[model samples]
Target: MPDAGTLQLSGAGTTKTLPCHAGYLSVSGKNNTITLTGHCTSVTVSGNDNRVAVDSTDALSASGAGNVVVYHWGSPKIVSAGTANVVRQG
Candidate 1:
């Protein structure tokens, strides 16, 4: 995300607001190619497949953990209620 502070998400019949799952976010990587996984759940993005700005939409109850996203390009962005990881590299 270009501006982590500006990253927001929404759900079915829900308003567009910041992610919410629990209260933890985890981010990790080197020089940018990061890997985020933890307490968060349900994700949404704007772009993907290497796009500079990408968005991911999922359910917060299902992928609270063990959800891996492999993007060929773009920055590593993760925003949820539990945990998130955002970085720029590669």
Candidate 2:
């Protein structure tokens, strides 16, 4: 189970938007596009071919192959443990 102010998403080939609220955002699915609004404390992505864009974040962890994560602001800590994963500031 997720803690308070945590948002979890899982699915394939879908696009969605959600508010981060300075909390955690977790995504697990293939070929999904997720956009997070506001500041996020952390973000975790654990599925193949996923795309995530955040307005701001303190940390980002990606453990899935072919995943892309873009942060618009802040120098977030990044951990990438998957093949072909991309995490960058945009």
What local lDDT does model 1 show for residue 3?
A: 23
- In model 2, which regions exceed 4 Å deviation? 1-4
lDDT of 2: 0.91
lDDT per residue as tens, model 2, 1-90: 223388789999989988777888899999999998888999999999999999999999999799999999899999999799999999
Looking at model 1, residue 17 earns an lDDT score of 24
- Which candidate has the top score in lDDT? 2
Assess each prediction's global lDDT (C-alpha) against the native.
0.28, 0.91
Which lDDT value does model 1 have at 26? 27
Models 1 onward score TM values of: 0.22, 0.93
**What are the per-residue Cα lDDT tens digits for candidate 1 across 1-90?**
332332333222222223323222222211222233222333333221211211322221212233234323333343432223222233
